[model samples]
Target: MPSLINDQLPPVRHYEAAPLTKEQLDYVDLPTIDISSFTASADPNVRSQLVAQVRSAIAKYGFFYVLNHGLSTAQTVRMFDIADVPFSDVDDDEKKKYQSRLKETGTQQGYKPRQYHHIDNGIRDQIEIYSLNHDVNKSGHPAALRPLLPEIEQFAYHNHVNVLYPILRLVELHKWEDMSESSGHTDIGSLTLLYSQPIAALQIRTKDGSWKWVKHIENAIVVNAGDAIEFLSGGLYSATIHRVVQPPADQRAYTRLGLFYFVLATEDVKLKPLNSPILQRRADIWLKERFQGAEVPTMAEWRKGRTKSDGNAELKASATNLGVEEEYLNGVLIKHYV
Candidate 1:
């Protein structure tokens, strides 16, 4: 497995499993927000109420389910059909033609073959991904997949304007093993909108430093806050620490596929904490402590560095054994440093 980190990738290391408490193994239901009223109503008060609900969910759990998001089942299934071709149907030799060389492109937009290893798991994750960015020219995806680009681009754009504006974004297809998948980590962007298959392997870290499964709700898009949002909101909203673990024993016979649309801030935007009313009252304590002596980086620089630093063994070791941390914000427990 090739390292995502450059020279900084640590040598293979052993990880000891930490025992989980009964509470840690228990499940908690994620908040579900229905945005149908916001999209349908012309009233400003209804819109404000929707915004308030979203804000509260992000601040507390950093993860939620969005209902009535307007994307039909047929449209989403079409996307899955397109994604399935390169990952499951194409010959291995042909698929390699689209493989991404991050060193050459200086970006992560393109196909990435399986066998990329993460230190926490000390093994290759069983998944292959194809990522497409907003700018067509900048995306290194192969021309063979161009036919599907229009629908893919439209879906991404709709989510951007309707959910949030001035955001960075990517559309990705993940063909994953039914068992082992991604390790615990926070996303590098502002928000993520994921359309997952029926299999439920995704898990979110709770305030008590425990893990809980994110139930699969049919036709619902799972939305979550990410690191960029935390930076923008002055740590009032958290970037949830979450992972895709192996499915339960009974589900091992099948594979899982996920279609993810990740939303981020615009490239040139400065990521200094915002002066919002929420942060003003709290004195931005979490923001101050998290960056006590570190210099703040612009959105572009932070994102570039984050992409490079992913799967760093040393960093993973220094954090928790499972690659997660917990902090409290305004009496709500939030997970980070994954």
Candidate 2:
């Protein structure tokens, strides 16, 4: 099969700003947690309260805003500055020099230019992305970014140990116009930490099935649970369904830059429900609805299948929308009916 990369790039298209719908105009904020106490306090009671708050947020919304995460505003600015070099400063030819053959590597690391179609809209989005996988330090990143690696790595490690527990290091530099961005979809990993650059283009699907804009809060990082965690939690926690859209008319000229850290479990971890008291109480009903009587696949097996499907356009297009295939290749439930 031909690779997903484009040999010929298309002209960038622009969209006119439209008025926000009633649902979009109103703001429904995500749960916000102050994690400083959780990390600082030695008392078990304080720690337990924090844990319960996190569990409640995940069980209901699958996403939250985190404050006091140790990284300062200046540190975040520096990281964004480093991220801007490749897309904004470097010439197109220089950027292409780092382009990756994702089909061959079976990974999303390295440079990917615009024209990648959105699954929901089927329109080519105007965006550029540079991905750094677990071996980013060993990988051939541009020399200009080397100085910032230590800080970035430290932040990733801290979040992994404190929140994700088991993680696969994958960071992405995403630069895109507010006019064209990602469609609503759940991430494949266990968790995702997104550092936004004061642009408010991100939105999350609410319980009422309406789209609500997620406002950009200063010094706060947006974190969301993914499919893997949802699977492990046995329907108690859901993976958030979200999308990046065009900013409102007033901010149309501003480009959106996001630093994304995707967290994955160890390869050997099974995609089965954890034996927690909360899950155990409803395991029979949840398991029946989740698996639909099919056996679950290991994390490694599921990742392989997911990457394979993503790389092949035809295969991805034909696959079942709700993940009910011949096998449970995707880590999430393969339900026949919602």
Q: Candidates' TM-scores?
A: 0.78, 0.76
Clashes found in each candidate (C-alpha, N, C closer than 3 A): 2, 0
Q: Give the TM-score (vs. native) of candidate 2.
A: 0.76
lDDT of each: 0.61, 0.61
RMSD of every prediction: 11.7, 10.1
- Candidate 2 lDDT by residue in tens digits, 1-338: 11112334221222222233223354666788888887688888987777777778877888888888766766555556656655665677776777766555556666777875433335666878887754446467665555546555655555555544311222221111110011566776777888745556777888877778777777777889887787777777887888777777666766677777776655666667777687788877877787777677666665555554442343233253543222244434322111
Per-residue alpha-carbon lDDT of candidate 1 for residues 1-338, written as tens digits (9 for 90 to 100)? 11122344222221211222222334568888887787688898887787777777877899888877766765556566666655655577776776766544335666666766453446666678877775444544554566556656666656665544311222111111110011677887777888746665788888987888887677788888887787776776778888888776656556677778776565655566766676666645764676664566666665666555444323313343455554432222334344
Clashing pairs in model 1, backbone N/Cα/C closer than 3 A: 168-264, 179-246
- lDDT of prediction 2: 0.61
**Candidate 2: regions farther than 4 A off:** 1-24, 118-122, 162-182, 293-295, 311-338
Supply candidate 1's per-residue lDDT for 235: 70
